[model samples]
Target: MNQYLNHLHVLRLLVQRELSSRYKGTIIGILWLFLQPLIMVIVYSFVFSVIMKVRIPGMDSSYHFALYLMAAMMPFFAFQEALISASNSLFANSSLLHKSTLPAILLPLVPMLATVITETIALVIIVIAAYLLLDQVSYYLLLLPFLVLIRLCLSLALGYVLAIMSVFVQDLRQALGLILTVILFITPIFYPVDMIPTELIPVNNLNPLYHLLDAYRAIIIRAELPGIGLLYMAGFSILLLCASVYFFQKTIERAKEFI
Candidate 1:
């Protein structure tokens, strides 16, 4: 009980430090967090809606592209940013490997928790804008908190494994950039899953990120419950989380020597 209490106290401080330091000394301050998503949304809207003249079937409006992109991009930006930061967490704090008294798992989790909080705040602005611009809001928006929780779990699970691996294979940093780029294009963030060939459905479903991005769209845009796939995603993430910790623990002794 005492150890659990101490862990909570330390995690609280670490999250605070991570959040504050993240935006510190920036010219735009916290607005910096929203900037990247904002730019992506604009670029996608212009290229897809304006140039390509693409139309999402159920959505009929001048701003449908913006709405479509916003719904999918919100959680995705959070997932991508959080995962990247969390994956690099161990390396960023390599010096603290032997020196820190707190649990090492807390290292990746700090960025995960910090990104959740920051993105939640930034998301509110995007949601409000979409509601105003489209004049369409669903009661299903109420379920978004639950969906966001699932996204957080999935991000943390993949992040911990990568964070540990990156310590041994420094090449992961460069390779991760290319991999995430391919994932972005393949994950249906800029397009709809219905466009995917029927043969590809199973492969796409296996991505886990596909489930998350699709769930966000389903709840916010489609205004429906996330499919049963989310249950599978939640299960996979928990198992992955367990395995990652075991792997990290077994390898941690050797990892410290390298660091």
Candidate 2:
């Protein structure tokens, strides 16, 4: 019991350090966390809504599209950032791992926790924007914490798997960026899911991210409850997390040698 508490304390400190180091030399510091996503949201909203004139079926105006995009983007940004940072966690912390008795799992966790904190702030901004811009507030928004938990589980599971694999296959770090880009374009982020062709619906269902973002949109944009599929996805993510933890533990010793 004491050991678990000690690890939690260590994890908290590591997360603080990870977050501070990310913006240490910058002028605006942690404000970049909010600004970066906000800027992207603004740019994408303009390009798609103003120039391209994209519109959703039920949503009346371009502002609704912007709000929809913001809802999806915050979680996706957090997921992408967490995965990328956690993937490199082992390599980045190699010296600390060798010098200290800290659990290697904590390395990936540092970045995951930091990303969560950063994106939670971003989500708060989105909520306020939704309330102010759209004159909308949903009781379903309360479910966001549950969805975020599922996202964290998914990110941490993949992080553990990738961090261990990256030690053996150094090229994975470079390839991951391209892979995530492909994932972003493929997932219905900028576009609505209804725009997807009927024949491709089954294939799209295979992507876990689609379900996640769908749930986010349902709550944020439509003020509706997501379907039972979200529960199933949550269960799958938990199972995958358990498997990843087992894999990470089994390979961590060999991974350290490579590190």
Candidate 3:
């Protein structure tokens, strides 16, 4: 517990430094963090709903299709940002790794925590706007925190593993970008799970991310509790978290030598 608290202290400082350094000389400064995602949501909403006329099955509520997708997309944005940022974090902060006596293992953790903090602030604004626009709220709203935690765990797990690997394999950083692009499409971010063919249901069920996104839509759009899939998401999160910690510790010493 003492070690964890010490790590948390280091994490907080890293997050603060990142937030400030990110926009140190910019005119808009921190506002850009909130603005960029909001703008992307608007543009994507137009292209997917207005131009392409894609439909989100099982979500028949009067809430605008854009908002429905946006709610689900926000968490995914955080997940992807944390992943990509963490992949390069060690390399980006290599100076600190070489010069500082702090736990080198914690360097990758910095980006994950930084992105989590920024995304939490953005999520609050998105949720309030969604409630006002849709004019509806459900008890299932209570599940939002659990869902966010699942995502956070998933991000940290994958981020830790990838961060260590990237130091040894430089090409992994570029490859991860391409892989994440493919993952977003197949993860049900743009469409509902039911819209997927029935035969694919069994296969899609294996994807933990599908369950997470489905759980989000269920609460916001379906107004019902997340069904069996929530359990699957929780189990998968635990499994990933454990696996990442094992991998990180096993390779952590080697990571320092490589960096």
Q: Which candidate is the best by TM-score?
A: 2
Which portions of model 2 miss their true places by more than 4 Å? 44-47, 50-52
lDDT of 1 by residue, 23-55 (tens): 899888767667766676567667766787778
- Clashes per candidate, residues 3 or more apart or on different chains: 0, 0, 0
- lDDT, candidate 1, equals 0.78
Predictions: Cα RMSD each? 2.3, 1.5, 2.5
lDDT of 2 at 149: 92
What lDDT tens digits, residue by residue, belong to model 2 across residues 1-259? 9999999999988888888788999999978888977776678667767887677888887778887988888899899998899889998999988998888888888999887787778787777777776787899999989989999999998999999988899899999999999999899998898889999989999898999988998887788999787888899899999999999999999888888
Assess each prediction's global lDDT (C-alpha) against the native. Answer: 0.78, 0.87, 0.79
TM-score to true structure, per model: 0.89, 0.95, 0.88
Collision pairs in model 1: none
Q: How accurate is candidate 3 locally (lDDT)?
A: 0.79
Highest lDDT scorer: 2
